[model samples]
Target: MDFREYQRRARETDQTPDTDGDGLIVPLLGMAGEVGTLLADYKKRLRDRDTYRLFKESIAEELGDILWYVANLATKLDLDLDDIAAFNLRKTRERWLHVGEKQGRLPFYLLFDEQFPPEEQLPRKFSVKFSQEKQGSGATVVLTWDGQTIGNRLTDNAYVDDGYRFHDVFHLSYAALLGWSPVTRKLMQRKRKSNPKVDEVEDGGRAGVTEEGISAYVFSYAKDHSFLRNVGALDYELLRTIKRLTASFEVNIRSPADWERAILAGYQVWRKMRESEGGTVHLDLVNRTIAYSSE
Candidate 1:
């Protein structure tokens, strides 16, 4: 049955039918109790594995019971199950698919430098050669493009090696996915110099440092989560913090999924870069992708 019809019929069965006050407590307790039962059933399935022939039937039964409790709770809370379900699905799609996302000529689709010369625009497609060299007790990365060093050599700067030297891939991912990266623009001499205001505010030092801060912040968070290895999604708060950090900048307009994809793509390339010590990072803004190749 449809959620609305099912909800109405289900309400008829609520032991603690919605009353003027506090009568919803029984359904709340029942819902919590059903969750425990669901977990116990799942544990049984995991423990028994292939031999648990009744696992499917039991899981379906438990889930049905839980759904009834959920509908009961929703009714007691004066909410519609269908409306809640629809709202949640829309939010999930927007976060996962980045609904209304678009692509354009300039990074982040901002027209700040669309009229600028090629030399002053972030290269839509290019490769940055990566090489690791020993420096003091720790190793550092030397990034070069067309045989010349680009950015200052980078290192983890921490007591241990966590591959932060290769963090530039994240910036490259931003350039590719969002068409925005102050760090990448500076490193490639792609700063929009035609307009002094744009140069100072959009492609200037503070923006570059802010981009670096974004990288470092996400790195610390990802480190605690195994560098986001096998992670399918990012924490909503993390994405929100990233937006807040960039709120004063042009990239503040990017969606959560945009940031999520960029972060994950960077880590995907990062794993390969870390394995090979260093590798060439490829950026393609048209297709919005960043990839790695061993040098």
Candidate 2:
């Protein structure tokens, strides 16, 4: 059955209050609780080998509960499950494919080079502002850069309240310093103009994986630096969440003296993956050139 049909059936059985005005709280809490239960089931199986026989069924039940809550939450928020799934897949495909196909491998040295102009040459110190503004029936986080409105989204309030908003800013700093943004932008433009389908699948996939690697680097840096205590917004939960997400990857940010090194590590991750797929990318930032080859 499709997501829309599942959502429709799930709503019929939902016993939660229809107009109690709990907003996103009920489903949010329910989802969290279900996830905890799912984890606990795995923990039990790990501790006792005899439980292996029941593991599959037990896990399936927990997943169903999780799905029910997720669907209900989407319904309450007026979001379609199919749309969410499609958007997520599209976004992931676009990001990773594009970067890998068009700009997978680069001059290794460029990743280490510091491309950020000196402070004297900088237009202004990098800064961001976060605030809440009424959006629809609830409030959303409004993000601004250099006193100009950039964008806003209905993010988990916990991110703002817990001071995890700096997470993206950290990644942004790395991108600017290493000049990856310009390179990625140019690659994207060229690929999109040449063939939109190729851009979406291959180019986008490369960009997606590159971003994941960058996130891994940023998390490693934050973990080593105590989440940059000087910022005074360090949230242990946020740090833990990031660590858990990137734990599967072996990548780590190695250069403490230069942030550019960390950014390069992120790029190397995508390049390595592309290499395994028989793709090669050679980039020269100074010369403003890119070459792609498939073996």
For every model shown, the clashing-pair count is: 1, 21
Over 4 Å off, model 2: 17-24, 94-262, 265-295
Evaluate model 1: give its lDDT: 0.84
For 45-159, candidate 2 gives per-residue lDDT tens digits of: 8898795788889889989988998998889878899999998786444323333224644233343223332321222224334454555544455545445655435343452
TM-score of each: 0.68, 0.39
State the local distance difference test value for candidate 2.
Answer: 0.49
Candidate 1 clash figure, as a count: 1
Clashing pairs in 1: 107-179
For residue 16, model 2's alpha carbon misses the true position, in angstroms, by 2.5
Scored by CA lDDT, what does every candidate get?
A: 0.84, 0.49
